[model samples]
Target chain A: MSGLLSPGTKVRVRDDWPETRGPCHIRTPHYLRGAEGVVEKHLGAFPNPEDLAFARPASRLNLYHVRFVPQAIWPDAGGEALVVELYETWLEAA
Target chain B: MSEVLETPSDRLLAAVRQLLTDKGVVSREEISERIQATDAATPAQGARMVAKAWVDPAFRARMLADGAKAAEELGIPMRGMPPLGVLEDTAEEHNLVVCTLCSCYPRAVLGYPPFWFKSAAYRARAVRDPRGLLREFGTELPQAVKLRVVDSTADYRWMVLPLRPAGTEGWSEEQLAAVVREGDMIGVTFPKVS
Candidate 1:
């Protein structure tokens, strides 16, 4: 199909952006947005970012609910109000 | 010829960039390319959009909803970009941007991030510990302002457009934009009057 990625397609954002997940690689910050607290919880989901970063096709992908305390994310976050959702795609076991 | 703090803006940028480059502190070519992208035609269009956001809430809302299009309203396009977002640094909170791995930035709108923003020191430290990182950037919030350090990985790039400084009761957009330094937009510095 014409939609198929060209073998020669540039590898910057299209390939690299999706695959990175770890402590040392460039990564997206959506899961960490307004982040606070620590892993008080963990919900589950699918595919590995390593494969996707290089544009490897997968049948499915999983999601995650990463918990954090507001104080942890925002120092000024007070009164125990905190938590964050992180896709399984955005995390590695810490 | 050597005033202590009196290098004009352009000359200051040149002198600092040149020194940093000479010391191998920054990649000059990459930085030059980034500068070339800005102008009247660019979506950020330099000063115009920043000026608009300072005065108009609806425009700022649009900027938050669809940065690419909001930029297009000012003429910025992100066709070749990964997912991008705009983080507004309000008075109550400060936003810090980092790649935490490598440098990932929404160049189309805010231009390239500063050198230290992409460094391993900032990246690793910012994620694991944000307060420390902010301090290194010369930002020390009171016990009240919360600090949020954001990691811009491969899937998305982000930019922070900090809140306008106080004391500009009736300043024009151009004046506001003039003070909107790259660092101010990135949460590294507050807009200052000359």
Candidate 2:
């Protein structure tokens, strides 16, 4: 929970949304909020887009490529895997 | 003037452009130049890379390692843009890219995202039913092949390095590139030569 995660780490996207007002911008897609997946790769730290979108002084966040099963995301979906980039703060050990 | 500005967003954009020009933040010529640059970019840039990768092993290694650098190696300017990740379509795996939140495309290499790419249906169905979506485009994938739907949700953008078509074995890079289309790199269709 406190350390950086490596590739192949099992993680779950945090379902809770951050409270904001006045045109809140977020990179974490709503459909992936509660989905669980394996960390595919750790993309280098970049400025948090949520803050950057609002013209605020932003801090860098670790971005990870998380691969999830398509069937798990959609019950009748095909066998394709869905890979998404999520901020480190939004992921937890699954 | 009111007739020209049809919508609230159009009027807003016009106002912003005027304000920026008035404040000396950006010149009108610079704006036009940027639009020209955007327009000049096309899938040919990506096709160049894909064709080169198909024939050259070393270049393919570099491209897979660093997509932006590989693009610059081929004289495509990638400055001030998000990092690009090249998804290789292997014999057993096929790659598809989508942006569910917005149309975050590799504009530097592929020009603008197509109208369908930004549509609600494409965005939703690309993730929900990618096979069905591809079939509509005349692409049929067997169950054995692993399909990967990459959501360009953050800092990185993506493009597919499609599996080279079978008939084009001895084709030159230029010949290979001619067959590489936008949809081929988008994973909705395959690059074909006849």
Candidate 3:
């Protein structure tokens, strides 16, 4: 998970979730799904929380500080930016 | 006289504590010691760090680089917690922190979180409408300033390093810390000379 992504990488948050993904207990927010953002920082790796939430053996996932502009998340909003920490599993190479 | 009633969650917590004690998972004394440690921490610790950063350039550099280590240098204990990061607010950019999932805070430095921080309304609105939320907290930022809202949704806790107020030159570190408030470190409000 550490080497999967580096800082400053362009990523797109996955918009769709499969039914097999199980219950929605992941840390990645629903509003950020399908949003495009730049990886601001690599915030170290931690055990996959989706697995950990269910008491399963958790694998590590690369966590990143992704910065999204207001226009990307909310078209009518001002020119502010939102930085959300996301795991590797919720992101795709844009 | 009537007996006091216990909420379902409270009863559940009691049952869990009993089970843990029975299973030898944790002693009551250990739990009490952990609670005491958490109680001992306060916003003053964070304010002291901010004040030190304001007066000392080297400490500021270390604080901005690694918050957890910088806190340790100041004798703040951060046992069994996630890494800590300090976000610096500059003239160009203002930073705010929110945890939409849960209230993940740097309690080691800032003590217990305020009740509003854990409110569902705050968690939802902070990300959806940050400026409006800030306005509610009496913070009116200039339109030109870039607002950077940070969501603490991972294994890292964050605190804001507010810019030192003007006209406070030649002030001692203790004096500077007196002006730094908990809300300022949380980025909901700014520190003033008064």
Candidate 4:
């Protein structure tokens, strides 16, 4: 997932869970799914924990600091914004 | 006639610890040593860094640039700890740190995680309603000031470099540090001049 997205890249979180959600463990929060945010910065690459959770050989995945306006996530949320760290696998080009 | 039982998480932790000890992966002494080191740290460590940054422009720049390195310059041991990220609070923007997934914190500087920091309500509402949470903490910001909540969801740990209180210009670094509290460094409240 490295070199796929840089800082300030616009991306959206995948709303649906993968069909093979059997043993793969996801670290991203459930509320962030289907959310739109811009990459605040690149947090470097780490071994994909979804595979690591199962004690499997894992490839590195790029982690990003993504910023979302409050309204983008919850319409009634005020003017504040949220910045969450997400792995590359959880994002798609917006 | 039933007896109480250990929670699943507690049982799991005990099992894992026993397994690790049995396998010789990590000795019990090593775990105790790490826990002792963490317990030795306190919010005063973070306040000291903030006070130094407040007095020296160069140190402030370095602290904002790289928190772990800046902490080391102040003789704070950061070895084997995650990178520290300092969030500077301005009149225009106030910064807060929360780990929605779990309580990932700057324990190297701030000691153990506060009870409220690990609460489920804080994790769920901090991102959803930051201003409301701040208000609950007795922090009332002006309507115009934009609140930015940074989720420490990854390897990096974060702390807030709160704005220096007014009327503290002539105060020494130690004096300034005395005024900076744990909540101030956490961005839930501001440091008081007195």
Candidate 5:
């Protein structure tokens, strides 16, 4: 609940976990995987939907947005897209 | 030899297949079967079935409350699938799907997301700017219709049942499904006269 993950800090998506461990959606953008970004916003201590979707009542993970430049991740992003937002638990130091 | 030996997208898919094989998540037979069932012509069959619910109030009611069983009514086997939730998008609520953790999808209904839908441009912008995302999808809404973007996760896969479009007073089932494009079913597009 108390940490200094201010804006422009390096963060990585914990990709090594089992495939079925987090929230289940149709498509997750490839850019944010195992990548780094800056913390643009913080939504506070809510049950991170990534884990909460599975009804993990006990294990609560904080969520935030880690922003990434379009070109940095996508080769042909054409620099038209904005930075990405990855939850806190989904990201850590790069 | 097939002139189209393999495209870049094909290679990517094959690589994912190989990775899945190595990871023990699926067998060669499993991949083959899944591929066999997937093709452009026949896309999102079961999800379309859920779409049919809108025309029929009874079915629509059932779909909203019991998506899984409603899917089963149409013979869409969902066993062994992860926790699945069908978010029916109404005129009041506009639902959008995003996988922040991984690209986990409900293959049983909606086939595969378009390459663009799985792109960073879509994932980040959908949440950061909901109206803009809709604009990209070519479904501009009045500032009055409040948009609510729902970011999905790895715990549960989502399928959106878009609100039935107006002007479809007596359209048959097939006529209705024709306008339900993949994007429409995903809550990105509004049903249109195709």
Candidate 6:
């Protein structure tokens, strides 16, 4: 509830790869890691899927819609923008 | 090359089903019934909502505000499902939906995802080359239009309310719904009158 990121905040997806953790469920796409974008909206908190995958006791985490210019993620992509919902833990202030 | 019978997921599914049945957690009849209910849902449910929105301004506003609730108004069950977000396509913008991580779709309204939606190629190309993917699906858009690609990666699910095509101005709701295909709501193609 406290310190939740707001819309329009500049943020970047944490570039940590989950390869070390074998057989993990990651909601964040690999292509989005390390990509910088703006917070489009706050989608409320939900149980962490990473923990739910393993049936671990999970805590709620804030989710936000992060929007980026297609070119930002892929250099050759068109000028349109793409939005992805990311858990707060996966993002940091850009 | 060695022949393969079942993948790991197939084995896991079979094992889980057996365990659940053995433990009496869920009966075999219940499992089959649930599967039947899931398969009963189809794109027509979404098309009906779209057609109603086109005809009634109030329903459209309600649907835009809360997609899940709006669906419930039409007798579709949304209990225990992820929130549904409806994206509106206008003259200046278009909305495309994808689940980059997996095929997290609005099964209550659209049933199961098509095989292509679960392919790795579609998942990767949706974010990397949305325009190219759309072109392959026979959807051509002008550069000026904002092609908003929405990734339903987490809790929320999304569907597109494609812009009504020109013509069919006096058409009935059934006629409008008839033109709406699953690809239209998924943002791969537009509903055509012809």
lDDT on C-alpha atoms for all candidate structures: 0.56, 0.90, 0.88, 0.87, 0.62, 0.88
Q: How would you encode candidate 1's per-residue C-alpha lDDT over B1-194 as one tens digit per residue?
A: 87676548978888989998899977888566545554323324434666788799999888776666777776465555554566777767777666655677667766656678777786666655666655666766665776665545434456677777778879998778877766666656667776
Residue A30's lDDT within candidate 5 is 52
Candidate No. with top DockQ = 2
Q: Between the candidate structures 2 and 6, which one is better when assessed by lDDT? A: 2
Better of 1 and 5 by TM-score: 1
Q: What is the C-alpha lDDT profile of model 5 across B1-194, one tens digit per residue? A: 65767789999988998999999999999877655655422345743675578677887777766666677777666555554456666566666666544465666677776787678787666656666778877878766565555456544556678777778789888777777777766677777864
Error of 3 at A46 (Å): 0.5
- Per-residue lDDT tens digits for candidate 6, residues A23-94, read 888888888889999999888899999999899999999989899988877789863889999999999889
lDDT of 2 by residue, A1-94 (tens): 4367888999999987764435678889988888999999888799988889889999889889999998887899874799999889889889
Worst 10 residues of 1 chain B by lDDT: B38-47
Query: How well does chain A score by TM in each candidate?
Result: 0.39, 0.88, 0.85, 0.86, 0.66, 0.92
- The number of the candidate with the highest lDDT is 2
Inter-residue clash pairs, candidate 4: none
* Residue lDDT tens for model 4, B1-194: 99878899999998998998999999999778777777778999999999999999999999988999999898777888988889999989999888988899998888887899999998877887888888999989899998999888776899999999899989999999999998888888999975
DockQ of 1: 0.12
iRMS values for every prediction:
6.9, 0.9, 1.6, 1.5, 7.9, 1.2
Winning model by TM-score? 2
DockQ, Cα level, model 2: 0.81
Q: How do the residues A1-94 of candidate 5 rate in per-residue lDDT, one tens digit apiece?
A: 2374776666766655445575463223454566656675553344455445566564544545445654566554422223333445566677
TM-score of each: 0.60, 0.90, 0.89, 0.86, 0.57, 0.88
Evaluate model 2: give its TM-score: 0.90
Model 1, backbone clash pairs (residues 3+ apart or across chains), number = 22
Poorest lDDT segment (10 consecutive residues) of candidate 4 chain B: B31-40
RMSD of each: 12.2, 2.8, 2.6, 4.1, 10.4, 4.3
**Would you give me the overall lDDT of model 4?**
0.87
lDDT of 3 by residue, B26-46 (tens): 999987877887887999999
For model 4, fnat equals: 0.67
**Segments of candidate 5 deviating more than 4 angstroms:** A1-94, B1-42
